[model samples]
Target: MTKNEWEQDLEQRELEKKAHNRGYRAGVKTEGEASKRVELLENVLLEFVGYDDKCLQTKPGLLKRKRADLVDQIIYQRQLMRELYNHLDDDVRLKLRTKVESHIWPVTHSED
Candidate 1:
């Protein structure tokens, strides 16, 4: 490709990478909120059932279903973030240098 084309493509990729990072951050935030809600709900449910072990054997009901759904959402969000991270080039990942990425997949300096 010509220099101009290469530059334009790089710019576009940069924009996409930024957008992806923003979405990933939002997803993480949502996941945290959902986790908190799940914890609260679990505590409430346990208290409501008098902390009985038999409550765990009961059939899935409203509270249990809601908790399950939130857990599923959290898992799905994590999977999406993983997929997005995998799709990005190492150069783009380095350029973004998001805290989440830094913690999970630290990029080393490359001579390229």
Candidate 2:
């Protein structure tokens, strides 16, 4: 092939590759944003549960009901987090799992 034809072919291939990469990156970004939203929701739920638990602890009469509510909220949050993990790409989910494990595992295992 002529030098011009070779250059044109190379340019076309490069453009196609760039487009493919852009689409892939956009997908990754969308998944990342969704994962972040889920994490934010989980944090909010945890904070609300913590506050509710503290409030209930201050009021003896409502303690049992509040404890049940807190447990339900925690379970819901965990389910949401799991769903988010399933939706994310493998690498993103792995990173999130690592972060959550590092921050939450010790506290979960620690005795008060």
Candidate 3:
């Protein structure tokens, strides 16, 4: 092949390399984000419900209730987080968490 043709082929290869690199980087980033999200969720669950390695060791009514409680806690926490997040400014929500410094309000309100 002529020198000009060779250079053109080299340039094309370089472009392909760069495109592949971008895609690879994006995939790595997506995988990493997913991993972190899952890890964080597990950690959060542990924090809220704690490690119950033996909770399911025995099958009865209480064990089932215990498992249900864990699910409820996760759903409750997610709901609280969602409500707090909804109140935040759009710009601040992404950069900061809604820190709960005050007492938690009752989930149900009673008529006076």
Best by lDDT: 2
Candidate 2 Cα misplacement greater than 4 A, ranges: 48-112
Off by over 4 Å in 3: 52-76, 80-112
Error of 3 at 54 (Å): 15
lDDT (Cα atoms) of all candidates against the true structure: 0.69, 0.70, 0.64
RMSD (Cα, Å) of model 3: 14.0
Clashing pairs in 3: none
lDDT of 2: 0.70
Best-to-worst order by lDDT is 2, 1, 3
Which candidate leads the pack in TM-score? 3
> Model 3, clash count?
0
Q: What is the per-residue lDDT of model 1 for residues 14-108, given as tens digits with 9 covering 90 to 100?
A: 99999999999999999997886776556455644466766642455435556666575456556666777789999887676665555666553
Q: Please, what are the lDDT tens digits per residue for candidate 2 over residues 31-71?
A: 98677567545555665566666533334533544464556
TM-scores, in order shown? 0.44, 0.38, 0.46
Per-candidate clashes come to: 0, 0, 0
